[model samples]
Structure formats: structure tokens, C-alpha cells
Target: MAEAASVTTTLYYYSIFTSPPDRSRTSSSSSVSVRRRNPSSLSWVLRCSTNTSFPWGCDTDSLENASALQKWLSKSGLPPQKMGIERVQVGERGLVALKNIRKGEKLLFVPPSLVISADSEWSCTEVGKVLKRNSVPDWPLLATYLISEASLMESSRWSSYISALPRQPYSLLYWTRSELDKYLVASQIRERAIERINDVAGTYNDLRLRIFSKYPHLFPLEVRLPAMDGNVALVPWADMLNHSCEVETFLDYDKSSQGVFYTTDKPYQPGEQVFISYGKKSNGELLLSYGFVPKEGTNPSDSVELSLSLNKSDKCYFEKSEALRKHGLSVSQQFPLQITGWPMELMAYAYLAVSPPDMRRNFEEMAAAASTRTTSTKDMRYPEVEEQALQFILDSCETSISKYTKFLQGIESLDLDVTSPKQINRISFLKQLAVDLCTSERRILFRTQYGKRPGPGSGRFTDGAEILRRSLRDMRNGELRALKILNGFRKLFK
Candidate 1:
């Protein structure tokens, strides 16, 4: 989503004053005192409040700062329209844009009502408390509350831009209903758990650890938007941009000064409503990272329903051999000889997962690599068939990839492992896995190109054709034999 823009004017506090009243009394007659100052001919009085009770006491300077902030918020102009509100009405109330636009243009200013520095030392708890105390009412969602209630508007320019407030990180603390009895207070712990699982805690812990180790920073400990400046929270006036694909604008910030800026990527004409992409930009790198296939026939104007988290049951792998073959590498393309697990361990998995043809090619290459690695390691007591084992393990890995990727890719195409924890509870995942393996075509790498017109003196395709047919027959027989062996093994285990 796009960020809010920086205002040209900077806020400054002048004087912290005491209200004209029985200053020491806790009666309702007490009032807050404030004074604001600026370099221009605009100097104003700001109000500072006191609780008048022992439970909530107000500081002198805080009152003064609040006063100054109030005056600044009051005098600021309206935002632009490219940043539309999700639920806010579009009458004479909110912001409006002054121009028309195309895709990727700056539509409005979205200032931060709450901004925390990227380098700040505050913890998630501190941030949450701050938001709870200072956040405004009327706007229920934090993202919306901070923007819609911050300021008043007059023209269309005011509607063009809104603000995004800073947020606290909230991790999903998982628990299972079956294991609730183990806790000190079963009902309370069960109520607190956002997700449920049938697996043992040890298993769950291992999965969580594996996920964190692979992608530590990728999962947010706290959910928050990057701020424009300072260690403060986003204000009420900004947060109006809704999700759209053919967006006109985006947010940018200055690292050193913490100032936020909004700029137009395209020209916005008067009266045209502005829009910004609410989801991550679709690029080659992002496509792989997120495992999002463009919904078939989806266009820029299509409505977005993005899933933000990764699915455990979906995994991805890469193909160094095919890529190398395409690039004319004969030695199995050693540099890209990479083994990535589910949740997209590295970038190559992204490229491999989206295209079925690519997936088929890469799986073959993985089989080859497994053979090579096993043969190389065999002198030491590795008794199992290396290639087959590795293929199973690779399939298992695919089952543990991110859920978000699965949602974006439309889960029907994944190669899942029924035994894996991620898919153990998912009937659809198991069903899809069976379908993929059963319906998939066999992979055949052409050692030499064939199926061409015979040369002038060529005989009726005798020796070469016979050899090719025999080789194909042998390959098919081997596959049948392997399937029988696997089926027998399963029956014996059962």
C-alpha cells in the first residue's frame, strides 16, 4: 500500500501554560492551557488539558505540544482524491484530488498520524500501548481511524492523499483444542490461541523453528507500516487509500530526516479519482517470492483478493540443469545446483513453481542431482536408493512451503506430501497431490533433437528409429517396475 506524504510546514511548540482557574483543585472547572508559534504572521493558542484527579495527571510541556499539534492539524489543507477512503463517504467531508491520472501517478498526500523511526529502540508492547492511548474513535480499524478523523477538507486536492498509521506487531500465538487440558487454565489458553492443530507441541515447535530459521524477518513479529518521521504515531487524517491495481501513486520517505513524500508516477488531471496498489508490486522477483500466478485473464482493473501469509503445505524447488541446458551448458550447470525447500527458501523456487512445464523440468533435474549426490556419498553406508529417497524428501519439502504462496498460486497445482505435518490435516492438499502425480506427463530430455524430415539419401527410418523406440520402452518398463516396488512396500507397511 502507498504511504502518506510530507507536509511543507514543520510543527513547533511555543509555550506550555496553566489554565486560568483554581489551578491546584480537581474540580471540573480546570482547563488546559497552550500557545503555538510559527515564523510567519500565524501564531496561535493551543489547549493543554488536565485530568484534575490523582489517577491521571498531565504534564506541562505535553499540554503545550498537544496545543501546537492541534493548531497545525487544524490549519493543514485537505488531502487529494487518488487516496480514497474505504468506508468514508465522498460528499463535502473528506479529501479530494485536483487532477486526472493514469497508472502509477501521485494522487494524494498520506501523512503519518503515528510515525516510528526504523531505528527506534521501542518494543512491540510500547508501541501498542501508545496506539491504544492516542488513537481516535469513530474509525474502528486502526488504519482507517488514524486518517479519516485527523483533519477537515475543502476541495478535491484534500481527497487525493490520506495517511497510514504506524502499527504494532502481533504474532499468532497458536494452540490446539485437544491439548487445552495441559495448560494451567484450559479455557483461557484455548480462547487466546488464534490457530488450532492436532500435532504435539514438540512437532509444532520444530515446525515453527524451521520456519523462523528459514525466514526470520519475513514473518512480522509486529505488523506495522513504515513511518514518515519521528517516534510518534500516525495522525487521524491520512489512511484513506483503498486497494486497486492500476494505481496512480505510492509513498516514499527520507531516511535521515524521517520525512515522508508522495509523488506522481503519472500525470493526474483535474476531477479524476486517484488510486494506489494495496498489494506488493507484481514483478518477476515478486512473482517468484510470493508464488502468485496472475489469475488467468486478470487485468490491471481486476479486483484484488490477496492472501498475505504463506501456506505450510505448499513448497517449491528449482532447476539448474534445464536452465543450463537452455543456456548451452553441458556440465549440468553446477553454479545453480541449488536445493531449496518449501516456503521458497531461495529465489529460484519462485521461477520453478509458477510454470508446470518448468516444474516438470526441475523435478527431473532434481532427480538427476539426487543420483549424483548419492553416488558421490555412497562409499559410506548409504543403503537406500538415493534418487528415490531424495525425490520423496523433495516432495515432502513442497508440502511445507508458505500458505500465502499456495493461496496466490491457486493451490490446485501443488505437489504435496500427505505424511508431512503441513498437509496431514488438509484433505484437499492430499487430493491435489494425488491428482498432480497421476495426471502429470513423464519428463523426457532430448539428448539429440529428433522428429525432423529425413535427409535426401536417408533410408526409411530404420536403425535410429528402432533404437529410439527401444530406449523409450525400457524407460517405461523401469517406471512400471518402480511403481510396483513402491506399491508392494506400502502394502507391506500397512
Candidate 2:
């Protein structure tokens, strides 16, 4: 959301992920044997079932473990200078400039020996071989690798790094189903979080059926099911760099240096915290993956999705639906709404939504523009249906805002389901994060419109942007940006 040059974490963005908290393993030099447990003991079957402290990993803010990781990396051939891990205001713990860092400086030359990828040697050779024999993907493979090494404790080379990882990573995947429904009931993010949770489950189920169930000796029942979270390739020192929406830098495999590195896009003074981008993510996306949200109005890239749907009873419903199908669109669609501008595809979809029977000829064109894959003209507009299209979007904006309002206003009265103090603390933390995310999402909707509740013929927007911009937050406190964009929308409407 912090609009700047963009990049992805090629050290690869590992979420605060999974595994069973309670388990015992005793290891020999050649292999680590895990004790078998019932399917009921598996944690991935219900990832966030526990609300209190999980015993799988150490505290996230453990500076002592962080200190040990630095020493281990130094001895393991990591060529690092200028930055060191330190407690920071932004991301709990992050890389801070040990000395003045130049804007274009290449930092953190983490060598291959120190890196963790799919090819990293497993503590148990047989376990690694079994996964590779099946050609398991990087995510699932690495997830299993983490839990395997973690179970070995001091016997595994990665003990310091694992100990530094938060026992409970602040991700939405760690939130229970009811927590999502209760706190985020009004937000579309609730649906996205549910889908992510299901994805982890589906991946686990697939692995269980195809691989784990076959090799109980290599991957005991508890280990296989609990070590199921995917989409991560852990890089020890490199991963210590916390995310900032403002920074445009990311870690990558530098071929010449034979290590992973991220070139700084902005200079840092000595003692200043260094930040890197975690891709261009929305407020909700950051929460879903990283379990943090940037403050409101700071992240320029933050946007809310506006859903537009076709009338079920419309006379042209079948024809419109068919046209949309050909263009890879559904009868209902969602378009992203940024504070600066909405997508051209949204404008086109809105035009399609309000088109009359006489204007049916334009259905395919509207649907085509709405599909991002379509190479055709993107800015086609109909002067006859212009006002109707703007009114339709205005109606959707107001409807979304009301839902956000209901949850935010009544948040204080929300009751907790937990009895213990620790569980209460966990739920309270999750609830506060939901409030931050929903508040940020709602602000974007408010930026677009404040017309009356949407209903048949929605006459509030009959006069168009004249009423629309006036209600789009009064723009008096030097909100010149909002006024500038509204003028563009006004011209588009006319």
C-alpha cells in the first residue's frame, strides 16, 4: 500500500506458519524417529484450535535467540555488513543500520551454505528422500523440512533460527473460524482467509493420501498432518528483515555473489531501522499473510474491492451472462477501488450493469473490457449510459460502507468466548487486529461515496458527481488529492 517501486520476497515470503506444539522425538545421527500419535492429535486438522501459547516455537520477540542466530550466520560464511537485527518500532524486530547505508548499497550477502531452500539437506536423510521421491512441491517440502528439523532441537543445525521464529506467527491462518466470522464478518477478507485456511487443509489432505500415509516411519501421523502449512522457503538471516509497505526492496538470489541480497532503494542513517517491501499488498492482504496492517492513509497502494452484480430478473440477463462468459467474466464481478482511481474495467462493468435493452449491443464490449486478459480497447464509454454507470458504482460504495460501520461501531460490546486469561489475551489481540484492518478498508470506501443507502432507482446519485464529490469527505483540510480525482470522475460521468 505504500506506493513506491515494487518487489517480491525471493528469499520468498514465509508466513508465520504451522506444526503440532506438543510432540516428542529422539534422534540418532543418521535419522530422527517420531512417535506415532492418533489423527485427533494433529494440529493442521484445525490450525487455530488452540488460543493460548503454543510450544512449537519460542517467543517472536526473543532477542537472545536473535543474537545467537547472528553469531551462527557469521560462522556459517554469511557476508553481512551495515545492518543487524534489533528491536524496531515497525515490525517488532527488524534489520537496523549499524552504520550509514547508501541508497544503492547492496546489503546482506547471505551465502548458499547459509540459505534454506528445497535443496537444503534434511536432518533425516530418509525423510528428505521420501518427499523428493514423490516430487513434492517446494512449499510442502519446506514445511515438512521445518517441522523435521524443529523436532530435532539442538541436534538440527537450524535451532537458533527456529527458536527466533514466533511460536504463534501473526497470520490470519492462526485465527479460528469463529474469530474470523465474529470480528471480520462484514469484510470480504473473511472469505479470503477462509479460502487460505481451506487451501492449507486441502494440501495436507492431498499429501496425507498420496505420501504421508504410505511412510509412517519417515513421517509419523502427527508430524505429517501438523507440518502442513505451505508457501514458504525459509532463509535464515535474510528473513529477519521485517516488511514495510513503504520500502521497494526485496531479497533475491544474486548469481555473481552466489548468495541472496536486496539492494537498498532508500538510504538509512546509523541506528535507523531498514525496511523492505513484501510485494504490493492491500491492508487485508498484509493481515491475511503477515498479521499486521499499516496505518490508515499511509499506504498509497491500499485498495478495497467493489463488488458489482447483474440483476437476476433482468430481461437481458441470459444475453449478458453469455457475453460475460465469452469474455471470462461471471454475472457478478469485483473490481479494486484505490483512493486515487478505480480501474477502467470497473467503469466498463458498471456500464454493463446499467445498460438498457436498446443498448444490449454493447454487452460483449463491456464484458470484454472487464476481463483483464482481454487485449481490446479498455476505455470505451457510452455517453447515453454514462450517468447510470456512475450511479451504480456510487450505490455499491455506500452499501459497503454501511456494513463496515456496523462492525466498527459495535466492536466494544463484542464478547469473548474464552475463560482463561491467556486465551482472552489471544482473542483480544486478534480482535484488535481485525478492527485495524476493517477500519482501514472502510476508509477507502468512504473515499469513494456517501450517497444514501442503495435501493431501486437510487435517486441520490441522479444528479451524479455534483452530489457525489460533495459527500466524498468535504476535502477542506488540504485534501487536494481527493478533489483532483473527483474532477476526473465527474468528467467521465458527463
Candidate 3:
């Protein structure tokens, strides 16, 4: 997957009002009133009106920026291709087909000189030398380099590319801590985002104290601050393409051509928006990293990590803890619960944690073997204790589902008109994503609990158990179809 770059607020916002000429051309009558509130401080509000042509309310600026960027690319070694930029529902500016393009056609061939990579030599040798001497990693180094160049405006060689980048990237990195806490309380992504934010801030502070303050001549204060968080690259025209879960197109470096290229595997109509796959990322991941979520039931790669911990009151708690410690395993661990199935490691951990007193003697050996050996879902079964493990897993899934349900109820009660439309949409998407994960996990548990029936003609068969097992089996089979479809879609992307 191509890593999405973070936008430098200082340069990004400046570029928004300076280079985008058409932004000033919008008529007052058709403009929509937008209340722009600072994420950190709500008291600092900026009232602005945006034209309705852009669904995201920044159409004119994006169109102008795209136009300027296209002209620049045309002069900077971009091939004369039948592709152009246009406003799209998914993103502010997206590359669209200007003419009919056939399958297997070469859509874009961006020269290496135009691509902004961490490996590329910096224009400012002094600053570059400092960065290289300190062994700064690619992400922060590139982010700082971008800020330095962007601060120069027209003097910067990559000014045109910088100007085209979105002023407000929809990434979760830009979300305020308060906003994340409020809207993403029940989701796991919130915790990850908070950790990332802290890491970035810590990195920036460390550099400032160690390098920037000592060598102010080489590293200016304006450029020293960290602006990006994840692995990033600036692929001029290629960055304009939006993402699609169904698309097989991916961006890659062509060593032979010494440039970036993306080949089309499917034909596109004259006005169709060109899409590239950002990778097999789940909706939760997409929303956290890219600031958008795919439609429900569309992402096959989606899964949630459910936390499992040992029961404190269990009779064999001390024995199990000691065994887990020897194997360098914790009593509490996270397990990936996917729509198709779960990892065998999860079941192994569960079995160790919930094993009875009689089986405690073998826990050390079992834990040691389990840690080193590969176990499949079939091997997860321990007939003597299968029911207990299944019950524990079921309880965890139920608890998660209840939390998500509560969040959904809270969203329903909010006055939509008073809240930011973007916030509302994001909150709703997250709620649905959580619901989907919980539902899938619950289905798997149901299968484990009731997919099998009592042996045929067994006199012990009760009416209630028989009916319950039959109903569960039917539902389980139906849910399995969804998992099959998801796996098939993933194969295409791979």
C-alpha cells in the first residue's frame, strides 16, 4: 500500500489561499455558510461561506490547485496522457479519464526528478547534511524537508506540487484529542491515534532539544517542527488519484524507467474517476489513516483485535500465569477476529488461560509448545474444555457488541444540524464498522457453539437443543458465504 502523506498546516493553508485563483471567483449568492472551528479550541471559530459545487465545500480551491499542478507537471516531464483532474464525491480533487482508456494501458509515468522521496538529495545541502548526520528516518526527514521547501514559496523547486496538496488532509492525525475521545470512544482506532500523536510530538520535541536548538543556522525553527506521522511520498500527479476497494491498480517504482508508474488493468470511460488500491486495509484502518471509510460489507480485509484476559478468580490462575511467564506470554493478549475466522494462537492462549486444575501440571509444556508451534483452527478444539473456551469468547464478543450499540444510540440522539457534517459522517461510519466486526465475530462463535447437531437417532436429543442447533447451522452457513466472498475479493487484490 502507498503510504498517505501528512500536509504541513503552515504551508498547506498558505498554499490554499495564494495559488488557487478560482477560489476567489465563487459567487456570494450560491455560497454555503460553513463554521470552521479549531479542533483544539472551540472558542476560536472562523465563519466562512463555501460554494455548493464541492460536496466537501472546498471545490474551487482544489480545482484551481489541480489546474496549476497539471500545468506544472506537463512542463516537468509528465507524459501527454489522456487524463485530467476533476471534482469527485469521494475526494476534493481526483484524476479522471479525459478520453476512453483501454485495459492494460499505461495511465501515468511520473519522472523520478518530480517524485519527492527521502532518498532524493535535498536542495539545501546544509540542512540535508544535518539530517543525514543525525540519521533521521525517512518519514520525519521528508516531512521536515517538505516544510522547509514549502516555506520558500516560489523559490522552492517543488512549490507547484506542494501547492496542489490538500490544505486540510482528512487524516485522523489532524483530529483533535477531544474530537477523537468523543467520537471514537468505543473504537480501537482512537487508542492507536492517540499513541501516534504522542509519538510525533515526542519526536519533534526530541529533535528540537538535541539538534535544532544547537544548530539553529542549519535547521531553522520554521522547518524543524514535525508535520507528518506515517511513511509518505510525494508522487505529484499520481497522488491526485483517489482510492477504491475494488481497484487492482497500485503505485510502484519502476527501476527500469527510474520513475513511478501505475498501469491500468481495467478500461475507464471518458468521465470516470481513476482509482488505485491503497492496499487491503480495513474500514477502521482507512478511516484512521485516510479519513474515509468504505461502504458496509465491501471491505474483505476488515478485522478487529479483541482483547482476552485470564479470569482472576480461576482456580489455576497462579499455575497458568507462571507457565505463560516462562513462555514470555502475558495473561492478557489481543487476538485478531476476522469475518472468515481467527488465528490459532488466540485459541491456544485461551485454552491455557482457562484450563482446569487437573490440566495445570501440563500448562508449562503446553504453553512452551504452543508458542513455538503452528496450530490451526481444527487443532483449537480440546473436547474436555471446548465448551468453556467458547463461552468465554462469546462473552467477550457480546460485551463489545453492547458497547458499539450504546455508541450508536448516542449518535442517534445527537442533533445533526448542530454538529459538523464531517464529524457526523465519521462517527456514523465508525459505528457501522464496529457493528460489522462484532457481528462477524458473533457469527463465528455461534458456529462453534451450535454448528454440530446430536448424533442421528440418539435418544438424548432434546426438542429445544435440536431446533436451536438447526437454526444456528442455517445462519452460520449464510454468514460463511459473506466470508467466502470477502476472501475471493482479497485474492484479486493480491
Candidate 4:
């Protein structure tokens, strides 16, 4: 029996049951098996009543995917890191976990071909349209490139993800019929493409960018994984990792070895359900990238406490205050969401978009509870509102802001609290408020953390301030100097 190492995952039954072609091109026929020490009913393999690990010849659907992946790895001519797949049961569904990981550790290595360049056309819907027609030399980079390009065309209002794109795109989606008509303006495209472009644009762009960006140097332009057909594939891992936020873990990339390392990011302690984020922000970007429809907000005519949590550390250092003030979008992970509507539903869509096919059906059942019931009250029963919300999230993934506002009007009308005129009026107010808050929060927090200069006695601070003062006083003489006070504060807090 192999001991579960600090960087190992559960021994998935599939690793043993299916035999893939040689990925390393060393041998045409060879097989491996994993043995479990403690067998339980919840384990992945059913026949292994006494063995906790998968048997050598067990066959299952997951094994099929693994077998294919194994071949891709072998033929890539990369060094083996002793990684394997494993299954665990929790609540109503099964999950995959990468066994061990260390903080600030690297797991997978990808090629630059797989990395979506920031300069790609995703920044402009107009550009995205042109790229789609262009032939991509590599298919693995297709989805990511498309998404990044689409995101540049729009922004997100929902999740922390989209706002974290290299650039802050537009955030709203789901345009009004009139609004959609406006974009088609002398541009010869049809209304349907416009709608879809809008959808993909608004979907969340965060997870895709951050998870990949954090280890950008690892992945190469072309992926080399073993395929079952005795060939190798260049499938980008970014094309994989689907989007479950809960009950999920990932393989880290090793750039030196040019291979993927595995680890679990989620655990049973979090919950049994699968949670995924559309690769972008939750508001409009999510819908655009993945076509996820979020639940609409209920007009309960009552106040619901919007919950925001800060750890003890945050409160002690006034980090919470700083966050609230400095809350504009950043390029790093941990971007915040402007949740005015159904967060639960948004979470569900994200989970589904990235979840393995086996787990997606389960997500649908769990999310059904959040869906508006037809028998519910005026505040709750708004299928139309839900649809509008869904459309907005999807549209923002790839479309523009002017278009998103138009679609938001459709969502506001579904609220039943307003007529056509009121819907139009509310649209401007909501979009402005969301955008304004995003900017204000970022600025305030940034300033609060670095706003004050030290008193006269504080030499370092005094000197810096004096330099700035002197420079300003001599406006025509030279450029003013600036210090990185915020960076200093961050290090202190950490």
C-alpha cells in the first residue's frame, strides 16, 4: 500500500480500471493499479468491498477520461510526478480531490501557447467577432482566448472574478430589444449573434484568468498529455478545470518538469455541494462566457441584511474599513462582487459551468430550490425576472455596457414593481450606482491605506512629503516623486 503523500489525491478507481496508451512513448503496452487500505461504501469503486482503493481492472466512465489523459501525458515526454485520480463521496454527489498541497506551491506547468495573451481581441466585441472567423492554430487555446477577448468587450457586476480581468470590462448584460437593435446599427450582423456575443462577454472572467495567471509561467503554448489513441494532445489545462467552486480541487503545474501536480482546494468541511464560478464575474460576465442564468432578486419590500464578513485580523487592522474604501477592481484574485440580486443562483451557475458532467446534474437539483417557484408571491414569482437576470449575466461575459444597460431594463420590468417608464429610469440608476461604487471603493481603500504622511519627526515619511511639496511648489521645474506606502502597509498587515 502507498502512503498518501503530502501532495497526493485519493486513489480513483478509474486510475486502475482503464489502460491508456503510453504517454511517454517508452512502451506500447503497460498498466498500473492503486490499492486502498480502507474500503467503505462511500468509496468510488463498488466491487472493492474490502479494499478501500480501486481494483486493477475496474471499468467506469471516469476511467475513460483518465485513460485518455494518461496517454496524452505519456507521449508528451514529460517527467512523471506520481499523480493519480481519486474519488470521494459526500452528501448526494462524488468529488475528486488532489491529496496534498503546500501554500504558495506550484502544481501544474502549462505552455505559453496555452496562455491567453492580454493583447488578444477579447477586449473588444468588435474584435472578438473578427477573431472567431480567424483560424486558431491551436484548439486548446480557443476557449480561453475567446473568453478573454469577449471579456474585454464587456464588464461584470456580480462576482469578484470578472472585475479581476486584466482590464475592467463592462459589467451588465441582457439588452432590451431596442438596445440590441442599437448595436446591430450599421454593423451587418444579426440580432441573435449580437445577443450571444453579449452573453459570452458578461460571463465571469475571474477564475479562468486568476487560476491561470497565478502560474502563468508554468503552462507552455502547447500542452503535451497522453491520449488513449496512442497519440499526444496539446489540450490546455485552462480548457479543463471546469468551474465548480465547492467540492473541488486542482492539479498544480510544475514548470521545471513541464507537468501538472495535483492538490485539493476544497474539502468536506466547506460543504457537500459543488460550487463553480463562471470563469468571469457573477453579474453579466458569467452569463456571457457560460450562458448561466442566475435567479432574480425578490422584491420583498423588506430589508435584507447584506452579509459581508471580515476576519479578526481585518477588523483589528481596520482592514475591513480599508477594503470598503479601497474596493475598486484589482488585477489579483479576491475581487469583490456587487451582489444586489440572487447570489445563491449565481453561485450555482458557476458551479455547473465548470463541474464534471457527473456532478452538473446534481448542481441542477440543488439550485432548483433557489429558483423562483411559480406558486410564490408577487415578490418571489418572477420567471421573467429570473430570465432577465440570467440573460444579463450571460451577456456581460462578451458584450458591451451600452448593450448591458438595455438588457437590464428588461430585468427591471420583470420586478413587477415598475412599469416600462420606471424600468428605463431604474436601469440608469442601478448601472451608475454599481460602477460608481466600484471606483469609489477602490480609491478610498487605496488612499486610507496610504493617505497619511508621518509627522515631522518621522524622518522617512517627512522626507518623502517634503520632496513632493518641493516638487509641487516648483511646478515648472520637475516631476513630483511618489512612494509606495500602500505596499509597505500590505507587508505590515501580512
* Strongest candidate by TM-score: 2
Model 3 scores a C-alpha lDDT of: 0.57
lDDT of 3 by residue, 1-494 (tens): 00112322322111111101111111234221111111111101111124211111122236876788789889988888788987777555678899999898876778877777666666676777787688776556766676566545676777776666554444556566776776666666678767756655676777778777777665533322333332334566776777677876666555556666667879999999887766676566666556566665677666666677888899888788788778777787666555544555665676677688888766875566445342322343465665455556666666766665666567555545547887777566544544453344444334433433222221111122432234444556767998999999999999
C-alpha positional error of residue 356 in candidate 3 after TM-score superposition, expressed in Å: 0.9
lDDT of 1 at 380: 20
Tens digit of per-residue lDDT, candidate 1, span 82-136:
4322222311122335445554543333333323222222223333333435332
The lDDT leader among the candidates is: 2
- Model 4 regions more than 4 Å off: 1-66, 78-95, 98-105, 110-235, 246-280, 291-337, 340-494
The residue-level lDDT of candidate 2 at 248 comes to 71
lDDT of each: 0.26, 0.66, 0.57, 0.28
TM-score of 1: 0.27
Q: Per-candidate RMSD vs. true structure?
A: 21.6, 12.2, 14.4, 26.2
Q: Residues 1-494, candidate 4: write the lDDT tens digits.
A: 01111212122111100111111222223221111111111111111124322122222224444444445544554344223333323211122323443334443454433323322334334333433343222221333343332222224111121111111112122233454353322111223335443333322133225332333332211111101222222222222232332222333334444333344343322223222222222222222222222222211111111112223342222322232234331111121222222233332232222333344334334234223221212121222233333333333322333333444444434335445895656455444433332232223223222323222220111112422223224432422222356667778999
Expressed as tens digits, the lDDT of each residue in 73-93 for candidate 2 is 888787757888787787677
lDDT score, residue 283, model 3?
61
Predicted candidate 4, C-alpha RMSD: 26.2
lDDT of 2: 0.66
- Candidate 1 regions exceeding 4 Å error are 1-74, 77-98, 102-107, 110-237, 245-249, 254-259, 266-273, 277-494
Minimal lDDT window, size 10, model 2: 34-43
